[model samples]
Target: MDIHFIKENIPLYVEAAGLTVRIALIGILCAFLVGLFCSMIRYLKVPILKGMVQGYIELSRNTPLLIQLYFLYFGLPKIGILFSSEQCAIIGLAFQGGSYMAEAFRSGLESVSKVQKDTGLSLGMTEKQVLQYVVLPQAISTSVPVFCANVIFLIKETSVFSAVALADLMFVTKDLIGIYYKTDEALWMLVIAYLLLLLPISILSSVLERKVRYAGFGNTSTVSGK
Candidate 1:
């Protein structure tokens, strides 16, 4: 292991780790917004809009993210649509994450039960109002465990963004290995750096899951906090 090399390049690793996190945080945020809107479209079964959303979700979920990134970063130029590598990576990741999130949310939303929706209607609440006031909050809460897992997975998956020339941790680690020819040391560093990024997220997910369990999302007595 090149301990001396790692020591000297500490600042580089730090910057790269920071970039990885920024990309993940922003990517997940964008993904959530996309998922939310798409889930609503599917839930409401909006005619033309739902078809578009379904195709997007299907394609994003089925295709490899690398292929999507390559298409966005490389293929788009063929059509005169140009985006920076950073933009392509971020957008591709966001769209991919959004597909899975949409399904999670859709399941959560529908899990609120038919009786609950009827009850809301009996109380003179419109369908949209029922969703806004009753369904969506519970859906978000119930979906947290899955959502958290997806967030962490998305963070790890950002490693592939290195392929697109993003200066994320994986990219920097690869750069270091290339420059120093210390594959073992660089990989060890990569593992530790990724643990630093993912461990806290795992712990937080557990805590949130526990809270949700105590909330009894599927029970009649417990109401959604959101």
Candidate 2:
């Protein structure tokens, strides 16, 4: 309950929080790209690719994220594909989030009517153009809430990177507790920092969900809210 201790360690928390946000943002962006690619492959039903994408989605969905992180951080070195702890943390978080994102996005894509696709074709648009112009926009607008939810989950999961000494907020909080022997102060600061970090994201998610639904893209339950 020492307010002084928490105040003194404010700079450390700020730095740690910055690192955490950086990692989480990078992971979120990468996961979205990965998810988009996965959804496209499955939607297109390319001969060999659809099967591979399905297997990847299933495997990632079923596995523990910790094991996935361990595989990237530890197992890669044995194959000479070395990565630092932070790098592995980013990659693993992105990969683990991507599977869930894939399913969400794929469902969004499919929710767009067959009539929409047919209309795009009747307008003399190429298949690629139809997807780019019609399908992806609606799909993304529809999937925003789910994507935001997954981003929040990914941010929380970044705490696991502490096990690899990635120096994120949770890692720095642990360090503060050990160094100062002030568990209450450090934990309080940790909780506050996370609250500050997550609050705006939650607010924006709600706002965006309403906007997207009102825009006539995501009102259906196919794009379920969290």
Candidate 3:
């Protein structure tokens, strides 16, 4: 373990980590929007869109993120479509994360009782209003823990960004190992960098989950509609 090498390379890893986090944050935000849209389509049972969303979720979830990034970064350029390495990284992360986010959101949506929607409707709320005011709020509250988990998962997935030529933390670590042969030091730094990135999010997720559970958002029983 070369303490001198690790100290000198700290800035390099910091820069790489920053890039990794930025790309992951953007990708996760896009994924949440995509997931929300797809889940809403599924929940509403939209005719053609429901099937399309299901297929997309199946395809995205089943495929590896590396394959997705390869297609975006390498394959697309061959066909006249082009994306920078960063763009490909972001898109691939979002594409992979969206399906999982959709499932999490759909699970939350389904946990809201049909009777809850009906009760809101009975109160003279329109279907839209019922969904907006009654269902979505509770659904989102119920989904918070899952959302936190997904955020962490998506962030970790950024490790694969190296495949597309992004200078993420993993990329820096691998590069250093290849060039300097300081595998142990580079790996230690990688582990420490990832721990710095993930531990807070993990702890925060637990805190959020406990808070959500204590609030009893989705834990109550409701009468089943015949």
Tell how far residue 116 is off in model 2, in angstroms. Answer: 0.8
Tens digit per residue, CA lDDT, model 1, 77-140: 9999999977887798899999988987887776688887888999999988998988888778
lDDT of 1: 0.84
Per-residue CA lDDT of model 3 for 14-130, tens digit only, reads: 999999889988999999999999999998899998999999999999999999999999999999999999889888888899998898887778888888898999999998999
- Candidate 2 has a TM-score of 0.94
The C-alpha RMSD in Å for every predicted model, in order, reads 3.1, 1.6, 3.3
- What TM-score number comes out for model 3? 0.94
Model 3's alpha-carbon lDDT is: 0.88
What is the Cα-based lDDT of residue 98 in candidate 3? 92
lDDT for residue 99 in candidate 2, whole number 0-100: 90
Question: If scored against the real structure, what TM-score would every candidate get?
Answer: 0.93, 0.94, 0.94
Q: Please give me the total number of clashing residue pairs in predicted model 1.
A: 0
Segments of candidate 3 deviating more than 4 angstroms = 218-226
Error of 2 at 64 (Å): 2.1
lDDT of each: 0.84, 0.85, 0.88
